[model samples]
Target chain A: MAAGDSGEDKLIARLFGSVATHPGALGLKDDAALLAVPPGHELVLTKDALVAGVHFFPDDPPASIARKAMRVNLSDLAAKGADPLGVLLAFAIPPDMDAAALEAFAGGIGADATLYGAPLLGGDTVRTPGPFTVSITALGAVPTGQMVRRATARPGEAIVVSGTIGDSALGLALRLDPARSGFAGLDSASLDHLRDRYLHPRPRLALARPLRGRASAAMDVSDGLVGDLRKLLSASGVAGTIEASRVPFSAAARAAIAAEPALLETALTGGDDYEILAVMPDHEVSAFSTFATAAGIGVSVIGHTHEGEGLSVRDGDGAELTLARGSFSHF
Target chain B: MAAGDSGEDKLIARLFGSVATHPGALGLKDDAALLAVPPGHELVLTKDALVAGVHFFPDDPPASIARKAMRVNLSDLAAKGADPLGVLLAFAIPPDMDAAALEAFAGGIGADATLYGAPLLGGDTVRTPGPFTVSITALGAVPTGQMVRRATARPGEAIVVSGTIGDSALGLALRLDPARSGFAGLDSASLDHLRDRYLHPRPRLALARPLRGRASAAMDVSDGLVGDLRKLLSASGVAGTIEASRVPFSAAARAAIAAEPALLETALTGGDDYEILAVMPDHEVSAFSTFATAAGIGVSVIGHTHEGEGLSVRDGDGAELTLARGSFSHF
Candidate 1:
């Protein structure tokens, strides 16, 4: 019954069809898209799914949710040092979701895809008897054999991270707290800054070129710094130590930590940072930092890779600190 | 707090990591996969999502659900005349789902991927506050510019379909019926056969090579033969007529229809056939049929294409028939 009218055909044409710009998309009419792999390049593939109530508040704006979905996958590609080509989306919408919400979600994804120069190639939309779920599979390109990968870092390499961390975690705290305005001394502007950071992730696309040439291993920090760093170390079969004080944090995050000392552990182990953690030789750090600075982003050397496995966090005095929880998990 | 223990990391290593056999998969260690597209081949990409209670019964066995998920996407690739390379899965599980269910789901998908030569590449698993949802993106390869397209059919071409058309729809009927066992003269074996058709789709991968060189236009029958044929004709700017008698049906479907003649329309338009429907010149039909027979699959010429629009169905007495509802839709 819905097939002839309000189903997939209408939804595609009305909301998301315009974003299928690539010739391979076949105007979103065909069963599959035909993508021509660029000459001398390899394709990078990544998938990420966002679920309502888990990944985001159920009432979060549809547009923001859409952007977050695409941004997270883009962050994965960015970590791999790949140039994004396009994305395929798979959406499962709750029966109660209105047309306005669906339209807003499509509009948001289309805007983000166009903004990032990666058009929507194809997608599947289905009905779910539950929360709205958005799953995206992003395709990217990198010159053959040039994809930056985890497990390639050598012992003694410096561990560098792109941009500041922990803002998103702190922002999420404020969002979940009932007495949101009771922060110790954080100004309204700082509060908004933290909230925005949680709502919108700034994926480090500009660092791809620099990291591809300089970094020995890389991964995006979706988990907390300590946790994600530990994963990278395990993958590379190397250990690392981070000076807790050296891990860059936003002014708002600093103020929150100052107000609640316990928040420092949350800052270290809180997920959703979306920053790029990279391992590079000490000599290449200055040049990489310079390039990142020119690109209007910050780069910090938090520690160095060692011969063993797992991550160690040290205070300013080199005293190792224990974390209650190492990373974020969905299980 | 599920991030540290029961969530992604542990689940992946225990359940799915071993399925990453291809070099591109990187053993699921990296953030993304590096796919080296073969020289002189283009990639075909398709995404499909199945939601519990919508696509399948929430209580269906995990293996059958996994197989159906992969088969639907494989059917899309088969229609496009593409060789499937790999698949990326995204799963959102309800909090109520036990570890056994999660393990069973992963095991089922892994087995299907191996069976299809579409090894697991990488995936994202998350928690959902609703029903289980599985989304997959399948990648396929075809020689440059050789993908069978839906808009290339010409007037005066023979329309053909592989396998029976409505067994799955009939199977669904029996599944939904409260008096499922009261069907007149239907034995348990016949009922199981019909239900199996609904649970497992046989994607025509063998048809790819034959159709690639012969079919003028092609697509998989997903939304029922009548509705899908209408789509193909619309895309190709042509019309077609089908002889209801020539439309293929399985023995079980024929028996069920004999018991209730009104079900003929449902057999023709209830969807979920997952069969290949192609348009080719009349001259190519015989050779194609022969090749398909040699490959151990049935091929039936049920209609012809003409220079017009929409699909026309003719009954036994040459009288035209109209379907009340032409396909299944989720809206």
Candidate 2:
């Protein structure tokens, strides 16, 4: 049987059958899956595609690639203040992708889907002569009319971010040039931390409820904090000033920047930091921070929104910082 | 600005902003889209991916590629008896894909999304080093617990297919070798008919309401009719017998088969025929066919289900015919 015929069926059944735990998935046999929305809820839909060599190294660990594919879209749901309902995967496997690699990739998706409470609903798989690609459409649910929007931020709001920033970008830099001396002073543990941050993103889904209740606007920071904040502010028709010194950084990221002061620019302008960025009323910041802390996630006030347009970043000395590029663009 | 940053924003706004007509789409400026299901409806989800040089020729018209991508998923919704709500797209554009091609591609998507009432909700676009790839996830709605399934056909149900089969597979054959002598006797109109059938699929969405009310089992015939029927039967835990002579064929398909007798098998087992294959109780077949006719779509009763484990096809003389292969497989 050709792969798209019986072969495709066998591959889907063997690799992903376990993940189709939702009753509506029909054991992956139906043409489409069914999902019921709660009476008072609305569906949140987000899709993100990751291609080998562009989004990640073609030789990256299969599990890591799969997890990143799923998490990136999950991050959008989290930012939208929605709880994951399920995910549908569209995978195009290159000729060089082996069975073992595929198994590992499916395993990673299943693990995350289970852990995140988003069971596999349904999906399509096909062969590709190009790079292995995975595109995921994640469905989430929020109470009717309560999804946080990036356009709702107002002047005088505090710009807050979840978890440390720049770690993923720095980690990507380390991965791109393993022998670079920029982080030579860093210990193996620090190096590992950077690499792990690059490999796996922690989507701030735990803060969804708090954000829905408190955020004036929200978005996930995937395209670097500076650029993403700029977009948020642009969408909201406001300007923001980022206190560069106040931008949260992991110990490893801080050490790497300490060894190489210029790496801070890369950290600020690089992409793949899947943390939540939100604008909240100034009075609600403290309460939101307390809620985040109780949930074991860090929330930092990196900037504040002011009435205007365009973004500005100021150093501790009040000197303005200029970046050649704001975020990574695939095009 | 990197294409993923500002470049992507401008490209999306210029190309697809008009298709984001749903108020919940947030004018395509938000991280995710919101969709509220009707109070008594369940969401039906399906995803399909198309890769250049794999699913379609790299040089195929951009509009056709886009329509096929959207229609393939729409076919699934039709098969499930669900009305389309919206669709999410994940596009990976290769370097060689020029601006004009992209404009045409986006235009095609916009046109189909509007015509089908499945407006573009949201999507993610990125650059790829490989061939252009499109992944679409379509969401549809059906009354709760009323979705037609592939696992419900009984031994007494009639196997019916919409439109004609084998035209697309033959069209592909002609495309693969334009100078091939087997189809030499075909007129220009016939050849064009076959090619068009292969390039574009007419999803039987108009039959959704009737199928929901009448079909015991349903699925679209993307793969060859024989193979797809086998799948439907297998899922329903029944066997079936297809009367090869009774299978519907277009004038062009008939002429092509007459010119090359062997083309009959190609027609029987070729894929890309995006017609709905449904099984209905013997008593319901007439009313369903009437409904399909009233909707201006053709419905053919090609076979009947039986209490067995595998599919068998009978020739005009009631002799069993063996097929070398059943359907087109992407793997």
Candidate 3:
């Protein structure tokens, strides 16, 4: 390393590895990161690219951007009950980005990698135009027949979710257009939580291990719970009924929702929740809270699966709310 | 199953299984794409992004750009002698690009993927500014004990190249900045070959299987031969000697080189070659050619490995020639 070399590379080098790592990665110093799967286990490999404007705000803080990129990938691994082995990051840095910003970005990536216990193996970095992008390809391992999929939810399954939903979308509302209600009157602590959810949402990797063969249809709530749950139901070939009142919301979230009635709609439709939604057999419903508690996470009974056609929200009186569907429509 | 509907859930239907395809990817309807990996063999992945103006000229044909992106990734897979299973492409199209051009780009990707027997598994798309960046991550499989590494080259091994060197860089020079003497009066056929070499060089996937149990040190020649070979030498902790007269150049390339003595230097030092460079004991030389021939590829020798530090090139008389050490230094 030269005294006046590019500082970002040096910082990235300092952060690419966690505790123990593959010996080959240490020696190769090449761009292709290498991971050795454990014996008797299969690997689940996933890749995701976060573009500057499309995925995140153009002026998003580099630290938050880095954390979000890693977190989104972790969300995928979490959905499958997969153990983190390592990851490869392919980044395109704009020419204008200074070495300091790049250093911070790399530091954030290192921090998240360390948090998730996933090593940063190897990657290639190149220069690009104004709106840059970061693509992370995460590799994980799971014992054969233990990984979860989004297609096995039985018709009479119980729909469940970990953590509160809509905070991330609410946070985006504040960041992009402050005129949107609910977020404007948020308390300091609530404000902080919202930002964290938007910028560095935690992936439920720890919960994945225990949910191994238990959860039926499972996936992370990326595009808001209602929206994501609809897709889950669709994939499972079952319809779902999520009680709007039974939906769990933080105390602060409830207060915010009260301030802006429109906030409920945003929370239901706005994307980027990143919580995990799983469908389990009706008997599994009684065990949901206990399982989540044992895993040191919270679980909420968000809905019920039925052998019907479309997603429906209901009230205490068991009357359908008349809303058409659950979440974001890509079309 | 709807009336005349293609069943494609628009972009959302394509999101899942976009990377690390699940075996039952097709089952995740109306939302995510699903394609699964087979058991036993783990995945070896590599990604590279090419920006339009930064990577190729703005006027460069979109199909060529698309092919080049896939080629670059395939070259990486070839370096490991891994079998091409599938690929994930993350392409950023400039908003100003013509719709036909974008279609051509996608067609080019589909065409090449089919050509190499590697299908397009999944990917994400977005809009970017002028320099259109195309990022591709290629996945391949190698037997547990067969994948080659760059760190295994030993001292006293012969440094050999799979094909003639310096053509691509010379070809690049002709396409970009055509005022050079070698291309100033070139015909379209000559220019087209040069452009194709620069634009869509083939990745030697077929050689991967045979090279797996062989090739002490190996890597694709993305940079010019001298420079890339230097990487192999450095990674292997050895040095090399280049037989300049033995360096195979195309007929037109030689004629072009004759027009300007410096053209040889460009060919020698320029990159984007996409060939393979390996180090092996003298005895394995014949086997490589035979293997390559059977695989329907080309191979040639241009150098020998030495005991010490830097690269040395010799002319027909076997005396060192005065030229730059390597091509495309990391500026």
Candidate 4:
């Protein structure tokens, strides 16, 4: 009940007020914001939270942490085929955090808010006796009844994925232990590629229009492609078959797997890719791919849906591949 | 990017899914939710964060914590003269929080969501190595361009407040030290009254419509009456005078103040009283009061606005009173 004092108020206004460009934000001075949902559109809502030592390294750059938090929520909106509206941030600042770090964090959010057209609407900031944490709730808009759903995929649809997968997982591995075995073969560029993928996510917002027009079901791959696909299949009450060879990977990821064959499982099941996994009619694959190409996004058909209740992965030799773990879970 | 594991997913579904009754929630099976804004209405958005050990007692009942968290955000919406639409929760669970406590917390949210007509739409949950925290983003709807603002109070307007003040601050003091000298004369019923007021906040949602129609400016009294009134005055570029004797107080608060005259300052400056403070033309006060009475909420005219630059509080004999601190500030 002890609300924000002048110190907290001044901190928020100085740090975040500039990004709240939407008039509805009331210049971060009001108790709430007003958003006019575009006519004939429905609002899409999603929230994601990141904590130090869990989602990212405690010493990671403040800008990177802010960008990751905003991107993760934006990725959900993209998967739902919704255009960005705005975002609300709930920030918990550890006592030891410095003013410079907070300024950098706010700068990162402002940068992304501009890049993605998701203006900073309003937010709350509080002191915490724990690690620094950020929780973002992103608002989006989609034409009425046009939001792509995870439960609408039917049997015999082609399963499509946008952008390369597994890079982030390998990047995470390199981040965890850069000198680990098999990584000795990687060149500096390849190592940087893997690491950058882990540090920053590219939310496939450009694919929203195409997905809304043609996709039967869709969701972003945050918890690994295989596990997330399983979730999608479960939601749709169907089964899926993924061709391992068809799963697109960046050159860096391919090099990492080539050096360490055991790392293939990590690449396939590791999370944080933030790519869109979508389902559409088999006949519409070409059209969807064309749209993706026009938008400068890479699209790959990795598998297909069928009338079953689980997922199967097949290797190049037509042999089934088994993963040590389906996906990374923060249990 | 290390997404939620099966344990986290199952925990969220089992503990919080039942309350996501909005059709747009898709039974909490999707990554995001879809909400259709009623025609001719705009969305009102607000977010608030509560951290364990800072915002509330860590050992408080799980249900009480949940209700307080939810009500604080809803209170913001009510102040905007909007009706509840839905909410998204971002929860970071401490390592030691138990499942039974989580269930009770979710139960509390469900009860309030039902009572206030703000169903849970979607949310995210993650394990944290920090204190338990809940960040809620509440959505509401108001007729386009009709949201009451904190920056529109004009000169000569009547400053009215709903319900009593200082009860929560007194309650918090009693809670912190039940055997404090000044509270020794308080009966058990009075003590409970103060404690319950601190634990639960009535949002005054029923007055939204009346405020939208009549109030020139409005905001909730969360950070004490004097400080919050200063904010409202500052935002509107005006000043005001308050009659100290006219400020409403609950029977328990009155008793506490009578027992210890010094406690009056604590009541005036103590935060956590979530009543509505509204401004309106002097002639409209009677109609506004009638509307509030019909809605079963108390209304008190305690002050008047004028073309000035600061706030002044006068005693019964017109002597100005000075406060050591204007409000409760966390920092």
Candidate 2: fnat, from 0 to 1? Answer: 0.93
- Residue B139 accuracy (lDDT) in model 4: 98
| Angstrom error at residue B135, model 4 | 0.2
lDDT of 1 at B7: 52
**lDDT tens per residue, model 4, A1-331:** 1235556557767778877888988888999988999999999999999999989988989999999999999999999999999999989999888888988999999999999999999888888999999999999999999999998999999999999999988898998888877588989999999988988998989989889969999999999899999888988999999999999999888888888888888888999999999999988889888988998889999989999799999999878999888876532
Candidate ranking (TM-score, best to worst): 4, 2, 1, 3
| DockQ of each candidate, alpha-carbon based | 0.88, 0.91, 0.35, 0.91
TM-score of 3: 0.90
Regions of model 4 farther than 4 Å from truth: A1-9, B1-8
Off by over 4 Å in 3: A1-21, A24-28, A178-181, A316-319, A322-331, B1-42, B97-99, B322-325, B329-331
Clashes of 3: 18
* iRMSD per prediction, in order: 0.7, 0.5, 3.2, 0.6
* Model 3 CAPRI rating: acceptable
lDDT of 4 by residue, B155-199 (tens): 998999999999999999888878777688989999999999999
Model 2, A43: alpha-carbon shift in Å?
0.8
DockQ of model 2 vs. true complex: 0.91
lDDT of 1 by residue, B1-331 (tens): 0124655547756677776778888887789988888899999999999999989888988878888999999999999999889998888878688777767777788887888888888878787888989998999999998999988889899999998988988888888882643346788888898899989998888888889889999999988899899888998999999999999998888888888887788789887899999999999999989988997899999989998888899998888997898766632
Give every collision pair in model 2: A4-B329, A4-B330, A329-B4
| Candidate 4 accuracy as TM-score | 0.98
lDDT of 1: 0.86
| Model 3: per-residue Cα lDDT over A1-331, one tens digit each | 0001245655545544432155535432542544557776765656667778777876778888888888887887788778887776777878778767777787787788788987766666776765768877666777877778776777877888888877887777667776666767777898777766777788888877766777887888876777677777776789888888887777666767899977777677676777778888767765666767877778888788889766887766889775444564321
- C-alpha lDDT of residue B122 in model 4: 90
